[model samples]
Target: MSLKIAVCIKPVPDPDYYDQITIDPVRKTITRAGIPTIINPVDKNALEAALQIKEQVGGTVTVITMAPPNGEESLREMLAMGADEACLLTDRAFGGADTLATSYTLAQGLKKLGNFDLVFTGTESADGATSQVPSQLAEWLGMAHLWNVSEIKLKEDQAEDKVQELQAKMKIENGYIEYEVKLPAVLAVSRDLNTPRFTSIMGVMKAKKKPLTVFTVNDVDVDRTLIGLDGSPTKAGAVFTPSLSRKGERLTGDLDEVVEQLLQKLRAAGINLEIKSSSQGGR
Candidate 1:
């Protein structure tokens, strides 16, 4: 049976111009005025997973994202990655969304797409790195979800089954865990899952002809109170360019003396060190 997969992609601030990213303090959202965007790295992994499945079985891959209209370019790039269709959810009301609002809007966008057998998303976005949207989206759409998936395998159902169930390996702190999730599950994957294919010239040409749909807040059915700055529960406490300034100190002396100086500096900087002989040491 063929599958209908939807991969949620995020157009994050391109790493090249990360320095140009600014913040709108009043609204508590990163201001993306001058920065460019690229498909979030891990989201590409999600798309790659979808594409692999589409190739194995006769199926379709659809890419979805919530961003400003400029995100259309990134959506186009995703289409070139082999998605049959692309949808962009953009509107002024979607601004300043923390994971909650973002997931809600994305859920509405997915609902607008009709029925899907499976949904894929990066474990977290490159820019936000919140790692919350996938689970939240699952809650909104009422589907089971898993995170940090490193491998995915499917169990086929005979007689043209619409939904293909999956068995997956997930990364955990100590080791890993495996699960057999039922159909219509939401999965958030890590970059370790698969290598994304590059966009070819042929893909680019075909993408131009593929459908790239756009939706506004009013277009998708969503509660106004649950989908924007007003709906987001988490408030940005502070936003600033992370300072990478390092103070360089030169210790002019022999090895032992320099080591002693470094120790002194570390102590002064409030870093405690306990060296243990031939064993464990920390703090």
Candidate 2:
């Protein structure tokens, strides 16, 4: 059987063009109007990784996301990037979701899709920045999880019985990476993983004819109460910009006197300076 892969993506406002993303202070919902949306940047890298895996290992790559119906634009983009198929989990009931609720909805969708060998997602959504959804989804699905992966390699070991065990190597942070136990796992990819390819005009035209599946929460056998506002554990009570206060002081003196004045200012501000000198002389 071929490996089955699914990449979870989000439709986010294009940060470069529309940086002013507003969150409802009371409802914790993102406003859609006037904000140009694009595929979440890191999620694009995740999709590219999935496509690369499929190209090398002979598998199908399915892209999935939960959002409003209009979020189909993101699906089309993924298809144009060479994903085999796309699935949308959309319903009015899935509104005002926090990371936990979002992951629950995705886990339900994954179950409905069936028989996935691996699941891919971005390390964090640009807007939320919570970095919680991928881990939560893995927990909900009872799968092993890896985070901050910059690269992935799959190796197949053939046994005498003609069975194969696939091992995955992932590049991690702190100049250290890990070799995971060969098993089905979920990975949250970092932006440094890969550069996503742009869709050609021909690819976009071809994507219009590709298969795009739409599923509601009910179609995925998800408990309605566990996937939306009712399912969320956290809420945003309020959002406000901090008022900026500007003040400055200027010191006119030689370098030593200036250094002394700076130290005095630091002391006045209750700042403690702990300096460690190097054992070896500065080069």
Task: Find the candidate with the highest lDDT and give its number.
Answer: 1
What tens-digit string does per-residue lDDT give for candidate 2 at 8-53? Answer: 9999877775446566777766565787888899998999988887
lDDT of each: 0.89, 0.83
Over 1-283, each residue of candidate 1 has an lDDT whose tens digit, in order, gives 7888999999887777767777777776777786766789899999999999888777889999999999999899999888999999999999989999999999999999988888999998777688999999999999989999999998877676644578998999888899999978899998889999999999999999999999998899999999889999988786666678898766899999989998998989988786545455434
Question: What ranges in model 2 sit over 4 Å off?
Answer: 17-33, 160-173, 244-283
Report the CA-based lDDT of candidate 2 relative to the real structure: 0.83
Over all chains combined, what TM-score does candidate 1 have?
0.84
Measure candidate 2: CA RMSD.
4.2
**TM-score versus the correct structure, for each prediction:** 0.84, 0.81
Which model scores highest in TM-score?
A: 1
Each candidate: RMSD to true structure?
4.1, 4.2
- Model 1: how far is 141 from its true place, Å? 0.8
lDDT of 1: 0.89
